[model samples]
Target: MQPGKILVAEQDGAFVIKLVGEVRLTLCTTMDDFFDDMLTSKGFASVVIDLVDATNIDSTTLGLLAKLAIKAKQRFSYVPVILSTNPDITRVLDSMGFDRVFCIRQEPVVDDEDLNELPVLPDSEDAVRAKVLEAHRVLMGMNDSNRAKFRELVTLLEGQCY
Candidate 1:
C-alpha cells in the first residue's frame, strides 16, 4: 500500500497541500491521519490541494476530502480548497454532488481565461508566489512534452498580471 503523500507549504495565510502519487484505497489511512492532524490545528485561513502529481485517485479519498470541506465550513474563519484534475474522478465527484461541496474544478491545463478563476487572494503576495511556484513545480515534474505547455501557461499568467 502506497502511503498517501501530502506536502505542505504556506501561501498568504493559507496552507497548500500537494497530494502526489497514487491516492487510492491503500493510502486512505495515511491521508486520514494527515487531515486529522490539520483539523486539530489552528492558523490557516484556507487550504489548497494541488493534485498535479496525482496519477490515480479513488472515491475513498474523494469522500474523505469532501468531509473535510464540510467540517471546515463549520468554522467561521477558514475553508479547505480542493484541487483535482483526473477527469474520471472529477466527473464522479461532480455527479455525486461533491463538486459544489468542495469547489472541485478541473486542473488548469493551459494559460487562458480559465486561469483567472484561480484563488489568488490578492491581499497576499506571498500566497500568489506560492501558488505560482507550486504550479511551475508541478509542470516541471511533468513529462518533457507537458512541460512546454505549462511554461506557456506561466508566460500567459505573467502577461495578465496586474
Candidate 2:
C-alpha cells in the first residue's frame, strides 16, 4: 500500500481535508494535532473530509475522523461531511457507527478549490500512543458496537503506555 498523506483546505469558515493513500496508526499524532488545531484555532461552520483516493484507512485514522465530527457537533453544532467514493470505506464507516456522527457521502467533493497538503508531523512514541489511545476512546464512546470492536485493541494499546 502507498504511504498515507493528508491534505487540507479552508474556505471562509469551512474546512476540507482529503485523505490519500493508506491511512494508519503511523499518522496518529499528526491526525490528533490537526484536530486539536482545527477545533481550537477558529471555529468551522463546516468540515469536509474527502477519502476518494484513500486506498486503505486503519482504525486509528477512522477514530480521528470520528473525533472531528463529534467535536464539530459539540463545538459548532455542525455535523462534518465525509466524502468517500470507495464502497469498502463506506462499509467500514457504516460498521463503525459513523452514521451517528458524520454526514457520509459517496460522491466526490464538488469543490476542490484551495486544497493544500498538510505536513505530517514527527512524533515521539509516547505522543503516538497517547493519540492512538484517545482516538480509540472516542470511537468506543460512539456506540456499543464500536466499543466491543476496539476494546481488546485498546486494552493492548493501553498496556503499552505503562
Candidate 3:
C-alpha cells in the first residue's frame, strides 16, 4: 500500500488536517511536529481532522489523533472534530475510544479545498522512536483495553530508551 499523506491548512483560527491513503508509523514524526507547531502557535482556537480520504490508519496514527484531541482540549478549550464518511473507519474510531475526546461526525469536512499537503519531514531514528513511544503512551492512557493492548510494546520501547 502507498504511504499516507497529511494535508494541512489554517482557517480563521482553526487548523485542519486531512489524512489520505494508508496512515501508519512513517507519518508519526511529521504528525508530531505539526501538532507541536500548531499547539504552540498564538491565537490557535480549534482543529479539525478530515479522514474522508483515508484508506487505512494504524495504531500509531490513532494515538497521534488522540494526542491531538487531548491537547486541543487542554490547550485551547475546544474539542477537536473528526469528519469521517467511511463506516469501517468510524467503527475503528469508536472502538478506540475516540468519542471521548473528539466530536466524530459521519460527514465530509468543510472548506477542504484550500488545504495543502504537509511535506513529510526527514526522519531521525531517535525522533521516530520518541514519537512512536509518545503516541503509544497516549493511546494507553485512553482505556484499560488500550493499556493492555499496548503495554508490552510500551515496555519494549521503554527498554530501548538509552
Candidate 4:
C-alpha cells in the first residue's frame, strides 16, 4: 500500500488539505501537529479537506478528522469543511453527527492558495441553501447502484462510529 500522506494548500483565505494514499494511524500525529501549528497562525476562514485520492482510511484517521473539525471551530471561529469521494468517510461523518459541523463539498477546492483571501459568505441565506441543494443534487446523481452501495456503507459506518 502507498504510504499515507496529507498535503496542505490554501487559497482565497481558505485552507485545503488533501489526503492521499492510505490513511491510518501513521498520520494521526502528523495531522495533530499540523493543526496545532495552525492554531496561532493567521487562521483561515474556511478549511477544506480533499479526499478524492485516498485509497483507504481507517478509524483513527476519521477520529483525527473529527478532532481537527472541533479544534478548527474553537481556534478559528469556523467549522472545518471537507471534500470526500470516499462514501465510507461521508457516511461516517453523517453517522457521527458531523453533518451539523463540517460543510461537505462535492468537488475538492481547486485553488492551491485559498488562504490569500477571506472566505466569502453567500449573499443570501437562500443562496447558501441553494448551494447546499445543488451539492446534494450532484451527490445524488451518482449511479443508483453506487448510491445503494453508499447507503450500505452508511449503515456499516454508523455501527462503527463512536
Candidate 5:
C-alpha cells in the first residue's frame, strides 16, 4: 500500500478532504487539528471526505472521520458526505456505523483542483495516545457494535494513561 497523505480545499464554505493511500494513526493528529479548524471556521457550510484513492484507512482515521461527522451534525444540523469508491473500504465504513453519521456516496468529488496536501502535524506520544483514546471513545458512542468492538482497546488505552 502507498503511504497516506491528506489533501484539503475550501470554497464558498464547503470543505473537501481527500485521503490518498494508506491512512493510519500517524495522520490522526493532523486530521484532528484540521477537523477542529474546519468546524470552527467562519462561513462553514459543509464537509465532504473523498476516499476514492484511499487504499486503506485504519480505525484511528475512521474514528476521527466519525468525530468530524458527529460534530458537524450536532453543530450544523447536516450530515457530512463521504465519497468512497472502494468496496472494501466502503464495507469497513458500513461495519463501523459510518452510514449513521455520514452520507456515504460511491462517487468522486467534483471540483478538486484547488485541493492541497495537508502537512502532517508532529505530536508527542502522550498527546497521540490521548487523541487515539478520544477517537475510539467517539466511535464507541456511535453504536452497540462499535462499542463492543472498541471497548477492550479503549480500556487498554485508558489504563496506559495512568
Candidate 6:
C-alpha cells in the first residue's frame, strides 16, 4: 500500500478531512492535534471525513476517528459525516460502531478543489504512545465488542511508562 496522507480544507467553519493511501498509528498524533484545533476553533460547525481514497485504515486510525466523532457530539451536539465508498472499509466502520457516532455516507464529497495535504507534525515518542492509548480507550468506550477487542492492547499500553 502507498504511504498515508491526510488532506484537509475548511470553508465557513465546515471542515473536510480526506484520508488517502494507508492510514495507521503513525499519523495519529497529527490527526489528534488537528481534531483538537478544529473542534475548538471559532465558528466551528461541522466535519466531514472522506475515506474514498484510503486503501487501508488501521485500528489506531479508526480509534482516533472515533475520538473525533465522540468529542464533536459531546461538545457541540454535532455528529460528523464520514464518506466511505469501499466495501471493505465500510464493513470495518460498521463493525466498529461508527454508524452510531457518525453519519456514514457512500458518496464522494463535492467542491474539494481547496483540499490541501496536511503536514505531518512531529511528536515525542511518549506523546505518540499516549495518543495511541487514549485513542484505543475511546474506541473501547464505543461498544462492547471494541472493549473486548482492545482490552489487552490498552492494558499493555497502560502498563508501559514511555
Question: Which ten contiguous residues of candidate 2 have the minimum total lDDT?
Answer: 38-47
lDDT of 4: 0.59
* Root-mean-square deviation of candidate 4: 13.6
Kindly report which residue stretches of model 4 are placed more than 4 angstroms away from their true locations once superposed: 11-13, 111-162
| lDDT of candidate 4 over 1-162, digit per residue (tens) | 887777776555566677778876555556655666665467456777788778787655665566667677777668777787778767765765556557887575555443332222224444433333322322333335434534544444444442
Off by over 4 Å in 2: 111-113
Ranking by lDDT: 6, 5, 3, 2, 4, 1
- TM-scores for every candidate against the unseen true structure: 0.55, 0.94, 0.94, 0.61, 0.97, 0.97
Error of 3 at 110 (Å): 4.9
**1-162 per-residue lDDT for model 3 (tens digits):** 767999999976788899999998898988888998999998898888999999999988999999988998887778999999999999989988999999999889756789999988889888788888988999999998899999999999988876
For 1-162, candidate 2 gives per-residue lDDT tens digits of: 789988888767777889889999888788788878888766456778999999999888988889888888888888888988999999999999999999899999776667887777898889888888888998999889989998998999899998
Per residue, candidate 6 scores C-alpha lDDT tens digits across 10-76 of: 9899999999999988999899999999999999999999999999998889999999999999999
Candidate 5 residue pairs in backbone clash: none
Ranking by TM-score: 5, 6, 3, 2, 4, 1
Give the Cα error of residue 113 in candidate 3, in Å: 2.1
Displacement of the residue 129 alpha carbon in candidate 4, Å: 41
lDDT tens digits, residue span 19-123, model 1:
667665454454555566666767647776667667666545655666566667776345555666777656655655554456665664232222211121123
For each candidate, how many residue pairs have backbone atoms clashing (under 3 Å)?
0, 0, 0, 13, 0, 0
Per-candidate local distance difference test: 0.55, 0.87, 0.90, 0.59, 0.94, 0.94
